[model samples]
Every structure is written in C-alpha cells, then in structure tokens.
Target: MFFHLNLLSVFRGVLYSDNSQGQDGVDIYGPIDGGTAFSGIQCKNRKLNLIDGSPNRISNIDVQSEIEKAKKFKPALKKLIIATSLPKDKAIEEFVRLQSMEHVKVGLFTIQICFWEFFERKIPEFETVYNWYVKNEGFHRIKQLSVTFKDGSVEMTYHPKFQKTVDRYIIPPTNNTAPDINPYTSSLANLLQSDINKMMQPGYNSIFRSTLLLSNTIDWEQLCWLELLVSNIGQAVVEDYKIELSLEGFFEKAEPERGNVLFNPDFHNDIKGYRNSNSHLYIEPRKKILVQGDSFVTGSFYIQPAIAVEAEIKLNWKLLSRDFTDSGTLIVKIVPQYHVIINRHEVLDSTDVREEISYSLIKRKGTYNIGSIDYHDKESDYPVS
Candidate 1:
C-alpha cells in the first residue's frame, strides 16, 4: 500500500529522535495505526578534505545516489539541509551543480559551510565568495561586515537590496549599540580650535594683535625675519620673563636693542650692564689723558664697564687707524705731579681721586696692564704742593 506523509512532520520527527534517546528498538517499518507512513530515510554528513589526499571534485555518481536516496523520502522531505566543513568555493560549486539537475529547486537546498575552514589561507577567496553571497543569496547575505586592525577599524552595512537576504543568516543584533564615529569635518574644526588656543597665549596674542593692527605698515620680509628670530631667541622671554610670547614678540625684543649697532655680530647683549661699545667711539687727542697701552694693535677693541673708570680720560676710543702706526709708541703717558688748592687755608688734596680708564686700540693684544706707557718724561717738572 502506498502511503504519503508530511515532509515537515517526518523531518521534525527525525531531528527530535536524533536529539533524544529512543525508548524502543522495534522496527516499525510501516506507518502506525491511523498515522501516515513515510519512506524511511538516511541523512549522512559529508566531509570534504581539500588539503590532504582526497577527491578534489564531487562526482556525478555520488550526486545521483544522494538524489535517489532523497527521492525515496521525497514524500516526507520538504527541504534538504547539507552541512559540510568543505572550502567555501567547493561547497558553492557543488551546490550550484546540484541545483542545475532536474527536479532540484534552488530553495530546497540549504547549504552551510564553516567560515574558519573554508577561508583558511585564502582571504581573497573568502572575500569573493562573501561578495557573491551578498549579491546573489536568496535569503542569506551579509548584514554587517566589521573589519578591525591595529591602525583603525571600520564597519559597513550592506545595501538595501541585500538586507532581507542578510537578515536571514546574520547573527542577531546585540543589545550593545554601535560606536559613534567622529565626523570628518569635526577633525578640521578641532584643528582650528587648537590654532585659536595658540593665538590666545599672552605673547602670541600680543603678536597677533600687533600684526592685525599694523599689517599694512609692517614689511612682510621683516616680519618673517622677526618671526624666525622670535621663535629661536624668544624662548628666553618664557624662561626669564615668566611671559609666554610668540615668535614675533621674541624677535621684537631680541633684535639687537634698536638704534644700537652690532660691530661684533657674535656679541651677547643679554647680560646686565653689558654695553656694545663698538658704536661709542670718537677720535680725540690727549687732553691730560693716560692711555693704558697693549703690545700689539689691530682693528677695534672693547673695554668692559668695571675697568672704564680707572683710566683718567673719557673711556671711549677706537683705533680706526688700520695700520699699527702707534704700536710701541706712547699713546699717552701719566705725568707724576700733585696739585694743591687752599680752601680757607686748609690744603685740599686731589690725590684721593679714584680713576677708571679704558681704551680700544688694535686687536693684536688680548689684554693690557693699567700702567703700561710708551713714554715717560721725568725731566720736565710741573708745579707741586
């Protein structure tokens, strides 16, 4: 007697029986009383070994045998679920081949291939298959693809056409929300804010204000040079003055004190009381002057403050004479004489006067003494007390 059964009921019963322990071993081949009979069927797992020695292709014979076996159970089978650990490409090829056969509906074949095994050592292959399934899967497509790396991470959603298919196979959405990304334009805004912060600093503020107020009058090249100087030498303003200045303020303050000429470019003007004497000399003959002379002579000379007062005359002189015409010659000599003037019959002495003297002659001598003289005349006598 021919018997028919619902495919859903048979498949459900088989799955349930496989999950639970069967109580009886009785071989009840035909349908039970008042129940529809089903053609007993067998479902087996197919293992495909792509790496080691094994058949690389699925043969037609094997396909035919499975087809025949499936035909017997056709009355009770609504769908065929095939699970394999085969590579994705092989699994897809086999599924396609099977679907091409007569009486094979594409919807009836539900094939599952493990991603870990299928994509092993073949990332490009996996991507190709993933894209294909996303494009063509009837009810299976990528809902979301997340890619992460050490540098950055990205996640993308598939287009609407594939959303339905993707929803069928994708993992259920989690309770956790997706992370928020900073907008591309927001990055530029942040950079602008940083620049504003820099412009707000005291020194920078001064410079920016000055630049804006005097933009039309200031020379661009000079401003650029000033900017460079401020950047390098302006660090001192922050260090010593307890004021933060921009490169402009630094350069403005650092540039050789205005109206002061730098005869020596290598001179340091930061130290206290250190004057650039290169700009302070005038040629004058001795007016009762005592010159402390050095041995050799050269271009110009510099005398510091502490020694300037010891010399009798004004402490400003430069030997503009490039020729050493005055070397070993008497620049000036001190005449040893004392003068006394009586104030109300009390003699006032001038011997107690403190003297400081400095002279800049040729550069041949590194240093000179306080008493060196080119000429001393003891024969001539002047009035004394």
Candidate 2:
C-alpha cells in the first residue's frame, strides 16, 4: 500500500484502478513520464529481518503470476513494474526482460522496477513505514553475551586463575533456515570485523593489535619474536615466570650423545637454560612480552617431534614478586606439524634427471588432526587446550 497510494502523491495525475473483487496484482496505474499510455505496478511486502545475508525473496515464479494478471487489465499496460520491499535479484530481472518479447507496448523500454535497497534510499516516506513496522510488527532485541574471564589477576587481586562460562540466549540447537536463528555467531563475526577495521587505522592501540594476533596464533611458541600480550586485564605487575612445555621423549635429540642436545649452551644463555622445554618471561599490567623459546620459525629453538603426535602438553607457570606469589597451570595440546610433498619422485636405483611432474606422485597432504584436549581434576586449572 505504501508504494500503491503513497507514491502516487509524488507523480501528479497518477490513476489507480480497482476491480469488483479488488484483488488484481496491478495496484497503481498511471502515465510514467507524463506522456500518453499508462504504467502499472505490482506491490509486494516481503518479511525481511536482515539476517543470514537476507536474500531477496521474490523469484521468477512470483513475477510470472504478476505478469499474467497485468495482461488482464482493460487497457493494455505500457509498462509493468514490480516494486517490493526486497532487493532486486538476477532471476527476477531476467524474467522481467524476457516479458518484453510478449509484445507489450514499449514495455522493454518503459519497464521501471524499484528494487528495495534503491527504493528505500530514494523514498523518505519509508521512515514512517519502518516506524510503523517497529511499533506494530515488533522487532527482536538480540541478547548480548560476554563469556568473560574472572575480573582480576591471580592471588594479587582476586582469583588465582582465569575463569569463563559458556553463555548464549537460546539453550537448544537445530540445523535449518528458520526465523528463530541464533545471532551469536553473526554478532561475533561483526565484532571481529570491527576490531580488524580499528587495527587498520594509523597508530592503533597495542592491546587491540595483540588481541587480534593472540586469537589467531596457535601458541606463544608460534609467536617467538613478538610479545604474547598481557592485558593484565587487571591491575597487577606479573613478576618473572616461565612457561614449561613437556616435549622430552616426543622429540628426537639432534646430537644423540650430547647432554644438551636441543640448545648450544656456549652461545645462548636463554636458549641454554631452556633445554627442559622452558620459556622464560614476565607479564606486566596491560602490556606484552616475548618468552625465551617463542620463535617465528617452526622447529628452531623448541624441541621438534620426530613424527606427528597428539599429546597433551602442560603450560604451568609461577609468577613470584616481592609482594605476592601467583602460581597457575594452563594445559594445551602440542601436536607436531607434518609436511607432505605431492607428485614427487624420490626413491630409485636408476638416478635420472626428472623433467616434468606426473600423477604418479600422489602423496596426500596431512591435516591438523584431533589433538588431545586438556583434562584436569580441577576446573580452570588448565584454562586453555
């Protein structure tokens, strides 16, 4: 009705035709650019909640029915328009263009359809329509959720370890394209995009940049050179501490006879002391740090496993200061990365120069398997896995 009657005000001397039953698809009929013949419109109001990309609902079948109805009007329509509260779709556009071959007068040239996005942008009266929709039709208030860590540092301020909860609006779950869909995933995605956009700005906050990188990194070991940001998220200066990675039997010793097989004790003080899979570090209130063995290059300082293995590695740490002694444990799975080269010729008695690759070298690429998740006697003892 908004486009049927309300739009007629914008165009002078626009006529509206009504039948006895008053159920024809053509709602508004009038001269398009103030010439001779009449233009007809089929108004549609589709329920659009604007979630999951909110695809345009109108299809070719719906437009076909409208075209048939527009044919039955007393005087032939010079132009047919489909004005709806939905975006213009490719399927419907093609169908509209094909109808021109049906020999409707100047319809190929005069067909003027208003897509929902463009129409709403051009029409100021849509604000009133939307207001009415909010009042009468109502809207969903998406519940906000934050599974936050306990709001303090270990023994210094509050709890000794980080804690969180699984929070959501809906309790149950299902798999289907329904109206009552969960907005948690969509909301989180939007927040990530917002965070990324903020980071793109010049001289962004260090905390913001670290938070983005921390979420993506597999381990502190994966980010050796860079600081593993400590937002402190609390008001305490975390003293000297060490992250212990237990990779003794899993990794093959470089020098089988040597006592310190992993690190050359003479050269590196930090690397020499970390022979027992230890990474030395300290954390400050709202700052970042790089522990001893954290490395950008894989299998450099830390012990590299001989083969791929899924083992639960412990990251227990103790932060000791003059005022407070804070000790916590965070267990995580350490799985060896496997590199596979496909379509390669290796083993052979006849050594010859290979010219080109072939399908015979069909070695499959290894993927990250189901690494062991942390299992502990106490909750929050091992916060991450």
Candidate 3:
C-alpha cells in the first residue's frame, strides 16, 4: 500500500513507523512542503458484519480517542487522516467537520476520515500496484539448483580395485629337477610382481568417493567429493533452511573391502551428512540466511554409487525454509571405471608336475576363469602314472 500511496502523492517524504510501543497511533507520517508541521495517517482494518453486509463503524468517540493519541506524536501533526476499509458515513463526516472546526479554533490539528471509496476509485489508474495486491499477478519465486563437477561434466568416473590373482610354479629341490627349471614361469612371476607394486598406490584405495554408495556401515567422513550450488531468484529472503538429497537408480552391493575405504581425511571439518535408514541424506544449510538474487555453494562432499554398468542416475532434492518449500531432480551420468588388480597367488597343488593342478580365483568379479592347466611336461624324464 505504500507504493499505492506514493503514486497518489498523498504525502511527501513519507516514512513508515515501527508500530511498536508508544507509536502515538500513527502508522505513517511525513512532512508537508518542507515545513516543520507534518501530516500522519492511522490505518484501521475492520471486518464486515456477515448478516448486515456492513463493516463495523468507527464511532465519534473512537475518532476523539485517536485524535488525542496523534497529538502526542512528535513534530506536531497539522492534520491527521484516519484511513479505514469501512464505507463512508454522513454522521461520521459531519462529526469530523465539526470537530476539525472546533480544534482549529482552539489551535489543534484538523481531522479527516478517508473511507474505502477513496482508494477504490483510484486503484484502476495504477496497474502495477493493483495487479500486485488485488489481481495477484507478477509475484512469484524462482528456484534453481546446479551440480558442479571437477571436470565440468555430469559424468563421474571411479576406478575401484579388483581382486588380483597370480600364478607361480616352484621346482622341488631334487637331483633330477635341478637343470629343468622353466624360464616362462620365472618371467611370469616378475610380471605379476610389477603389477602388485602399482596396486599399492593411492588411487587404488579410493573407496570413499561417494556417500551414496551402498554399505552396511560407512564412516561419513570417508565419502568422495561432490559439490552443489543453490540459488534463490525471488524478492523475499529464505531463512532457517534444510535440504534433503537422495540418489535414485539401480545399485549393486559393494564388496566389503571397497566399502570400508576412506576418501578425504579433512572431511571431518565440514558439515557431516546424516543418512537415514532409507538412504536419504539430510544436509544443513551452510548459510542460514539466503537473500534475494543470492547463491551459495556447498562444500565438497562424497557421493558413492555401487554400479557396474553405465547408467543414468537422478539426484532428487528438496529444500525447506521458513514459509517456503521447493523440490527438484538432476540427472547425472555414472560411468564405472574397472582396473585389474592382482591381489594374491594361491598354490593349487603341492605335488610334482606329474600330478594334475586345478584352481579358481577367489572373491573376484567380472573375470573369465583361467580354468585348469596341465603342468606335466610331455618330454620330461618323469613318467606320468
């Protein structure tokens, strides 16, 4: 309504009062022609009587009481306007005129009653204020959310360790086996040894990359890095906010070895994510107060997903704030990175090569079976029974 009053030029240099204790019954006050004297307005909104279709009237006594209160206002009001939603009344107008004349005669301020008819006639002249309050147009809030990746793309690539297996042959210390050592098996051992050294590096242990990964139990601080940007494009402010995020897609159970691995050691300093029984994570706002046209970026966090095949994942998010709520979904492309890791070697059989050797790789996924291999040399002096 201040905008409406501005357009009507009701008062120059108008200012709204705090309306707190000892306001002197003036909701708004302003100067007139740069003079010492000021004019004030007191608003009274009254409900209409349902049976009579008439608003509760303001009595002459009520006017007299407000006039007394306005007299206490600083700068000394030269005129006081009592604005109400109630329709006009002839008795009230006549009472106000007689009271104004009587007050003017005694060096008091003049009194005026502005009824609903005064504003109703001028509303159509100003479309902006009219549409805002009456038509409920041109008023809305815009919510936007964006995900930030290290490589500036929606796809996340993770290379988890795969169970390693090695094959080795030992020649028995005997007089007959001394000169028949196989060089092929010797070179194979050296190759497997080199692969084992690479697995001991840092990236091989990158298990806590994402908090979204399915785990029976995981340390919240060990998850991988995932960042998000939140923005508010409305005119109002958002305060006391809470955000909920959940990943939606098919997830395979991760191996216990991979699930227990920790990501960044400094994750303890940031806000820890709370995961519920259903795998939904609740995150607190880093900034408690979000003003209009402002944006905030969340700290780096982990998002672990246990998926073997390439697939599209949806990040469903919801924001809750004081008197406002919003929800949205973001699509993320997840590409699984697979690297062969030779963990350990197993001795299939302890007997001589004349005996058959057979074995299978243990605790391994996505590997073709090496099956059984015959170690017995056809031309060797040892005869097969």
Candidate 4:
C-alpha cells in the first residue's frame, strides 16, 4: 500500500517517487519543487490491537509516539499527517486535539489523523490508479521518457517484439510437380530451388528475376526503421506534456530468410529498438518527432491480398492518455515487392508460355503465365504489369 500510494502521488503530479524509504520515519515526501501545500504523509495500515489491560479499542499513547518519531525527520515538515487504515474514536480524536496544542510538548506539526474513510470520500480514484500501476509496470516502472523531433520519423528498426514470440515457418512443397506449397515438405520442395538460384545470378534467373517481384506472397516479417509519426494539428493548443507509446497484440517473429538489421545505420548502437522496448515521445506544440530506438520492428499484420500483384499499405495509430484513448487506421493500395525463383523452368516454359520469349519479358515483366505480357519499354512496363 505504501509503494502504490507513492506511485499514485507521482502520477497525480503531487510528487515524483524518488525519495528515501520509510525506515527514516517518512514514507511520502513532497517534491523538491515544493509546489503543493501538503508536505509529508506517514501511511500506516495498523489495525486495532486488543491488549489484556487496555479498555480502549485504540491506543493514543502509541499514536503519539509514532507522531514523535515523525518530527525527527530532517528538513522540518510543514504539515505532518498520520494516515491510517484504522478509524479513530472520540477518545483518540480528543487526545489528538489536545496533543496538537502541545507543540513544544510533542514535536509533531499540524497533525491530521486521516482514516481509511478519508480516501473513500476524497481522491477516490487514487486507489484505482495505484492498483493499475502495480499490475502493469509493478515495483520497478519505466521512467517517463521524452521524445523530440521536428519530423516524426522513426529512424531505425532492428527486431520485432510483442506480448508473445512465435516463429514464422515456410511449408515446403510435397511433390516436385506440385504448383502449390506443401506444409509437410521442405519449403524448397526439393533440391531444385537451391540449384535454380545457383544456376544463374539473381536478376538473370528464369524465376521472378527481379528481387522486387520474386516472392509469391507480399509479406513482411519485419519493417525496419518504420515508426508512426504523430502531429497535434489543432486549433491554437499549447500544452507542455508527453505521451507513452505501447503496442498490444502486435508481434512478429524474426525469420533467418527474412533477416533483420544486424546493425542500425540510422542511430547509435545504444539506441532503442521498436520491439520489447518502451515507445515514448515528447511532442512540443505542433512539432513532430521520429520515435526511433532499439526494438523489433513493430505493428505486424500479415494481410492476404486479393490480387496476386497488388500494392498493400497499412497504417495504424493511437492517441493515448491517462483517461481515454483514441485511435485511427488507414490502408492504402500499394505495389507489393518480393523475390521469387521458379525451380521448374521447363514446366513454366511449356505450360505458361507456348512460344519462346526474350529476357525482357521475363526480366522486365516478371514470369508471365497468362497472355504474353509484352512491355513497350523495359523501364516503363517493367514491374507495373
């Protein structure tokens, strides 16, 4: 309860939780800025102790001693409070009033014996945020970070991280003649694909010669240096604040074939990556910033395209806050990029193309199955068709 209450104190802008422990007789202390009037709080969850000789449910003498210990705190407290979970009776309340008058008699200052009922009436939401902090960040929470940049561009992407990790596997072909992939077989189908890539250089092969048009699937296990830029374009708004970026249910496991950015060209090695790391930035007014660091490439959804050769663009963003969160998404048609090499060149030449075609048809237009996809200019019609 002490730890959570201090966390709540920091969240509400009362004080930052960077103080000494309660062993020195001070559990909660005001911020160094000393902005708020209230100075210290001694949170104690003591219940009524039933002693043999004691007729009273509460002990005023023990409470007074606790208050005395509080006075020994360095940098004299302005308003010392005895916040307790147990309720105070008429006897205890009267004793506290009389003790307040005896400032010289007792070294406590303006003592307020707060009951558990006080939180129920005032500052009710404190408990809720405290519980949430404990569940999410827990004892060691991620400190608030500041992100600043004129252009909101996430500079580098390294690895992909999420709540869970799962590997991406390629199901191979069962038979050498099969056109479709077989989950049970090696993705290579046989030793044929390995030989095809070796037969000729990447671009001159009978396969989707161009690396951009190689793969059958337009998929990305990771998108490096990819970050969503956020701008607060609004009507004359001036607020000095920061925001935290977190992705839930967003993940992608790295594949050796898909590969990753072993070294970040954009930022230093000590920088953060999108995956398994915190996404935080401080936006100044209408300015923008690039949310870049050491992390796995974030935001992954393997979208299956309707057309074989079609562009697929996906964008997702969220405006988060302590209260409510607003988000938006946009998906635009984009030209898919990939690399593919046909292991069975004889089958494609016989079934797909009846007549012989030039490398321009294969290189520029990619492998054609339907009507001879002849291109006017190698540059103009190359990857478009």
The number of the candidate with the highest TM-score is 3
lDDT by residue for model 2 over 174-197, one digit each (tens)? Answer: 455443432221233554577678
Q: Per-candidate TM vs. native?
A: 0.17, 0.32, 0.36, 0.27
Per candidate, the number of residue pairs that clash is: 16, 3, 14, 27
Q: How does candidate 2 score on lDDT? A: 0.41
Across residues 1-385, which tens digit of lDDT does each residue of candidate 1 receive?
Answer: 0001121232223432231444121111233224553323233223333222243444445444554444444344333333222334555556545554434454332222222242333323445444543444311321221111112212211111000000111232356765333121123245445656766776675755443333221110111111101111111111111111111101112122222234545543321221443323222222212112211111122222111112211221112111111111111111222222121111234453333322221111011223222111121211232
Off by over 4 Å in 1: 1-13, 16-57, 90-101, 104-385
Candidate 3 residue-wise lDDT, 42-151, digit = tens: 77665433222233688899888888899898878898888776778889999999999999999988999888687667555656656654434222334343333434
Over the stretch 1-385, how does candidate 4's per-residue lDDT look in tens digits? 6533643454332332333534334566663345534456666665333222122244687667767776776667666666665555677778777777787466546666676566545443566655654464232232222222213443222222111111222343457765653232233233336545555674565533444244332122223233233443322221222233332222222111122345433432212234443322211222222222211222212222322233333334433332223444434342333222222233322235333311111222123324323332243211221
Report lDDT (Cα) of residue 243, candidate 3: 69
Clashing pairs for model 2 are 224-294, 224-295, 343-361
Best by lDDT: 3
Candidate 3 stretches greater than 4 Å from native: 1-161, 164-224, 233-236, 252-272, 307-311, 341-385
| lDDT score for residue 368 of model 1 | 22
User: Each model's RMSD to truth, in Å?
Assistant: 41.9, 29.4, 17.9, 17.8
Could you tell me the TM-score of candidate 2? 0.32
Q: Is candidate 2 or candidate 3 better by lDDT?
A: 3
